[model samples]
Target: MQQNSLKLNSDKTQLLLIGSKSTLTKTNNLTLNIDGISVSPSHQARNLGVIFDSTLSLEPHIRQLVKISFFHLRNIAKIRPSLTPPTAEKLIHPFVSSRLDYCNSLLYGISNTSMNKLQLVQNAAARLLTHTKSWHHITPVLKDLHWLPVSHRISYKILTLTYKALHQLVPPYLSELLSPYQPHRSLRSTSARLLFTPTSKLRSFGDRAFSRAAPKLWNSLPILIRDSDSITTFQSRLKTHLFSSAYP
Candidate 1:
């Protein structure tokens, strides 16, 4: 305020303490005062449409998505009998799947239980769009809609970001996280570039970091996909690859 000539809006200010479960437990009751205004700690905070919990578990976020998405899914399901598959898919993607994919990169390395919750939401969306029976296998339905499973969607988001970062299409903050994967003996003759995934002591947290997940997902791609010079081409091929993997 003194330097920039701007005043802090204490009333609108919120504080969040992020940490592991045990770490959060220790600071759960902690509080702070900024310029004599008490800043209460929040168990969960929403930033850029993504919810972050104290434990970084994302359960609250997932529950919120599930609640809102299912409301739309049910409403759409009621009207599905009167709509064509293409029309239903268009509505479903914007309303339901969009929510699932929003900021989903944060969900990288999340537990299977949490992944399953989102998957169920997507499965429901697919079935509702295609008017498939509840007992039908979801694999075929997802394939028909050309939709990647929830987990693959997350990876897709990460890898897409990674590609942009690698190609200098995104900001330095993201591009700095990636480094070309180098072999000890030098395999520089390879067609497409690979990325090195940094290791961390904190497995759960580290595993989900863009630095780790980006390279891991990047390296998993076929050489042709990785070698794609055009972002559009890469995304197209990557989606096809993921769709095949999901349904096959």
Candidate 2:
């Protein structure tokens, strides 16, 4: 910063130490001295509209999302009675769905409990659009709306990025994280489109990383979807595959 002639904004700056729960617990109260300023670690910090906690569980972000989503849901519900289904859906997508989908690829390996909280928000949004009763089944409503569940939505985002990375549509930093699997010897399955999955010793943390998760998800996809030549085609086929698995 000094070399770049950029002054630090101490008031707006935040320090967050990311690590496993055990490691974070042991390092509580850790502080850093930067240019004669004593900065303490925050349990959570906001970055690019996403909240990250010390342990990277993302519970803080989820909680904030749920709160904001419900606030919009309530506002939308107030006027849903006067709107057509299509109009209601259009309104909800921007306020609720977009927030759910924003940076959701980072949510790929979150706990089911956290995912359920987001699912409930989507369920409420779907119900608001269709005027469904609270006791009614949400799956059928979601399926009718052609909306993938929260989990599948996360996968869709990841797979889309993976496709872009493979095709050089994304930055080199992300593209370099993935490598196409090439067999040393020609075999019957040599035509299969697959990515080399890196070994991850820390399943809880490392497996959720884009480098590991992207390959794992990409490999699990059918060859037709993986072999798509264009991003548009890949997204269309990818959604159908994920929707089937989600609703099946």
Q: Who wins the lDDT comparison?
A: 2
Model 2 scores a TM of 0.95
- For candidate 1, write residues 51-113 as lDDT tens digits: 898778899999999999999988987888899888988898889988998898999988899
Query: Cα lDDT of all candidates, in order?
Result: 0.86, 0.91
- Candidate 2 residue-wise lDDT, 1-248, digit = tens: 78999988776678999888777778846777766788998889999999999878899999999999999999988988899888988899999999999999989899999999999999999888888899988899999999999999999999999999988899999999998788899876667878888898877789999999999999899999988889999999999999999889
Q: Model 1 misses residue 13 by how many Å?
A: 1.8
- Judge candidate 2 at residue 248 and give its lDDT: 91
**Model 1 regions more than 4 Å off:** 1-5, 188-192
Error of 2 at 214 (Å): 0.6
Candidate that would win on TM-score: 2
